[model samples]
Target: MQSTSNYLWLLSDILGQGATASVFKARRKQTGDHYAVKVFNHISYLRPYEVQMREFEMLRKLNHKNIVKLFGVEELGSTKQKVLVMEYCAGGSLLNVLEKSENAFGLSELEFLIVMECVVAGMNQLRENGVVHRDIKPGNIMRVVGEEGQSVYKLTDFGAARVLEDDEQFMSLYGTEEYLHPDMYERAVLHKPQTKKYGVTVDLWSIGVTFYQAASGRLPFIPFGGPRKNKEMMHKITTEKPKGMIAGVQHRENGPVEWSEELPVTCRLSEGLKLLLVPILANILEADQSRCWGFDQFFAEANDILHRTVIHIFSLQQAVIHKVYIHSYNTINVFMDAISQQTNIPAPGHELIYEGHSLELDLVQQVNVVPKTTEERPIILVSKDPMTPIGITYKEPDIPMFPPKFDLINDANLAKVVTSAVHQLLRITNSLMKCQDFILRGVYWMLAILKEECRKTTQQVTALNVKLNFCKDTWMIIQKINSLLPQMNLTEVGDVHVKLQSTEDFLMSISQNVQKSQKQLDLITAEWSKSNDIHHKDNIIGKVQVLLDKVSAIYHQLKKDRMRMKLQYNEEQIHKFEKIKMGIHAKKVLVLVRDDCVQKYHKLLTSVKDWMRTACDIRKLLGPIGEQVKNLNQNLENCEASLNKTLDHCSSKLHDEEQIVTKLTASTAHLDQKCFEMVIGMKQLKQEMEDISQELQKNNMIIQSGFQEA
Candidate 1:
């Protein structure tokens, strides 16, 4: 987007909208660049005051070109709606591109690759900066159309982004649930004593999901109708195998997945490219964070694929117009058609001249018109009739894939030969994998059991603990294959099928064992009963301590095993293939060596083995946990006995006291009657003695003294 202004600014158009903000394309009042202004309305009260500011601060500090650039923040009148000025991306978004595609599926393999490269690069920078893009979808990825109409993708929208302080974890629920990591969703579902925390890894999961959507024009994890539809989406994201995520309509015999639906014909992806694509997808969609690929690993893996997957760009000099421009991935026919539009000449009557030869046939026959921009040569487009007068020159800007050229180089055969060699190498890899299918089947079955076990782990970890990372990666790879591989129809790239199986087996084995150990752990945890009842009795704390210790040991061992795998697995092996290029064939055709590409294929196989090994650690961490469970059970029994004894003794004492009180009451009543009778008798005896003394005192003076004494 371009802007030329010198007065008051004006809103030209609405760019987009979200729950909290609305973006618009605006003209600058001062002479400068065009920008998008994000306006936060009264509905901003739906969130917090600092929420938008946090995003602004994040963008302000981030200076990477892949990340959206922030210009300034402003407030409109009265309501004080905040407006954030930012770089205007003229190319729109990947989602818009997919929606506008003539084909149902989406962009071609080359276009997808370029966009992904930029997205990954941006993500890497964010991770390094300790930021997690909680929301990562096609809508959040913007495209910049350069002056020459070439495109570059950039990451945008920090509204859902989280800046980690000292890399601390986030416990609050944030971001779009559709793109939320499965673990994060599970956490939201199981908010009671939330055990899992959201980290930067969640961003990768969203990236993988976005990748799948871009490749297949549909989500791998479909959110269906229901009250718990969100949970269902989370479930699918977390559970589906990478290869099986985007299943095709008809299952080809021994196809990679059950839903092996064919891709749109426009995406003419080769089998060799698919071999690289599937594994990377699997790596990203891995459900287990421990087993998922890191940013560095993903970037390196992507680079490897790019090296093997070629997309040509070309330089063009229209001599009749004395003008120059570069264009790529366009065929000679398309180029001619464009020229015909520009000059009003019939495309059939025009020709693309490279080294004075017409390339009309090549342009018409190529699946997608790609140019030879990688080489240091240029081609010319001219009228087939020599008598046509030279036209006025209209110079165009240089393109990304094409450069300025005078002497056209026509060498399309090299690509064909290299592709053929790549085909043969794929067959060899496929054969190797087929030979070991039996072993892989064993591993596959085991992993399936493990996958089942993981699903059953609802007790120990709520949906929260299980985020969709590794699984998303797998889904992306399969989606790519399903969306693009159908058109290629090449049987040679069997290596992809092998690698996918390898990943599944490896993931399942490690997961199955860990889960089995976890299952044992969960059972133990359940038996211990963490009932929140106030009257409940048990040595829960002591037992939990043991459980924690036991689980930690097993978890640490698994972690150590992963580190070991990383140390041995090298993605930098691209250096070996970097320098092995063939010399130009007498400056006639660009020479390509089949041997070098073959070696690269062999290297990929080795890497696949390494990839498999990373997920192959199925070592049992169950022994200590089992022992702890036994101890907990025994401790529980002892607690039960002590509690029962104490309660029984207290009951007996209460009964004895009740009996003693009843007996004491009865004795007191009898004793009171007897004492009353004795007192009455004593008083009567005293009166009788006094009467006798009075009679005696009347008889004698001596008796008076006795009476007086009485």
Candidate 2:
């Protein structure tokens, strides 16, 4: 066993028994600081190694103020038994506080907020570090009472936590009773391990349960007794509604007295805060896990909540006003100078709406709003454009009057703009097709140049072979004449020697001329073979192979170019189709507006109210226009569908074209192989001619010696 002394602590006694481990109270010998060490047992469950590994991975990485700090870990020499050391809390668990304070002081709103904030802080930290506290309950939170009844809270327990991933594998058995997500129940019944497929929403659901009971002093959904069956618990979690108070309790029927009776609690709690917290909690508890906010969103919201809470705790009015201005941007710049005097606010950007004419406001560089003031400044609200498109008619080019109110978000107009932008993008894409064409032409030119060189090499090689053959014939003839002079017995024929010499001279000259011609022809042939067209020819074969390769490459490139052209053509067609669709949608909307206007014109003839008459006429005209607009939209959708179908067809054709191109490449390679063989044959013929010429020269020399002896 590993020595306990090495861990800088001494185990005083066993603290408690847990589901998967036992907790022991230990104190650091050096500092005398107490800690709770949880020992893990492997054999109690199957696949203990995997479980322990997971636990260690999660616990070792956690670092947060509200979260229980892990001091260290100890492992025995060979056993799977490992001990996790953590900071000890003296105020016991939140469960004890809840039980004691259920009726006494009734758990005030401020107190509940404080405790819940601790839990949220710990959770927020875990989420930022990419961890989840899947099990969040009153028992997991430990409270430490300071002097004069001040309590400090910390979050503990991570046996059920899960890390999120794009495709994480989770074991469904994680989480505890009354806190398990609805998905966990489904997973358990399905007998499947937890998958990292889920987001951080799972942890949020557990936190919601913790927060609900803490504030209301009762479980939001769970039954009051020991534990309910799976069916009962799941029903409550899924279908049960929020109740004002716990059941079967007469005195505490209206919720905790301190929390419920406080008409106005701390300024920290705002309507926005309540509104925000409820939805998050509800979403986390959703039976469908898909809708839950993942860790990314949770962390963002938690930070915002913390920031807001901190500002409130400090009684900083500027922070509260800054938060309000962020939500609503109208008339914010009017107070910019006043706000800047006390706070660190700077000039705002596109997201902010300036409702005043202040050149000075624009001059400032920063955007943070600060300080609180009551003096109102000169305000000028600039209205945004309406969703309804108004036709521009110029009688003498007059500026249009702004509307009384404008929607910052124009849903219909936004869609129209997007459709227009898409059409423009399609045009740009069509232009890029020309680039592909240029590349295709370049590739084609490369192949053409290679093929021409191959042809030239092949012709030169053929000419060389013919010249070699001619030299071979001439050398054979010279040898015949020389042989006759030696047989004529011209031993004393010093005069005969001269005649013999003349014949020898003629033969030597002929041989010399033939040798020169052969050398020239060989040089020409070798130079031709070295061309890029023939990359690898022994003599004739390499040149031939190069020619074939050039032809094949060109053919393949041509086919690819054709496919690319087709794709470009299809894209153009789709663009035209989409434009038509947009035109139709716009026309239909115009028609609707016009029909309504026309109807109003007819009603206005009898109405006493002049404004009503005008409005009625406008609406009447808009009706038929609307019908036309509807038709245009339908036609546009049809065109879009057709274009999409064409795109699919083009994709399928591309695949088929690729296969054909591959086949063409293979056939060209085969042709190259055949050409190589032919070149090899030419080389062998040249070698044979050289051997014959050498033999003939030796015969002529022997004949000259015989003539001198005679």
The best candidate in terms of lDDT: 1
Q: Rate the local accuracy (lDDT) of all candidates.
A: 0.48, 0.44
Query: Can you give the lDDT of residue 42 in candidate 1?
Result: 69
Writing each residue's lDDT as its tens digit, candidate 2 over 306-379 gives 45421111101111122122222224354343334323334331111122111233423333332232212111
User: Which stretch of 10 consecutive residues in model 1 shows the poorest summed lDDT?
Assistant: 582-591
Please give the RMSD of candidate 1 to the true structure. 38.9
Q: Per-residue lDDT for 1-710 in model 1, tens only?
A: 32222212345577888887888877677555567888776677677767757898888888887898888877665456667888889889877876542223445555777777788788878877878778888889999976677678899999877787434678777766666677776666534355777656667778877876677565555433421444543454365545423322212322322343333222334333454566676677666677777777887877665544243212121112211122344455665565565555677654343433444456655424444432223334333332222221112111112122211121122222332223222333332232222222322333343334344432222211121222223333333433322432324333433543444454444445555655543443342232212113323233323433333333333334434443222322321121112111111111111333224323433432432233232212322333433343343334323333332333344345445545665678464564454444434433543453343234334322332332
- The candidate scoring highest on TM-score is 1
lDDT of 1: 0.48
Candidate 1 ranges with C-alpha deviation above 4 Å: 1-12, 46-50, 165-168, 187-194, 223-237, 240-268, 307-710
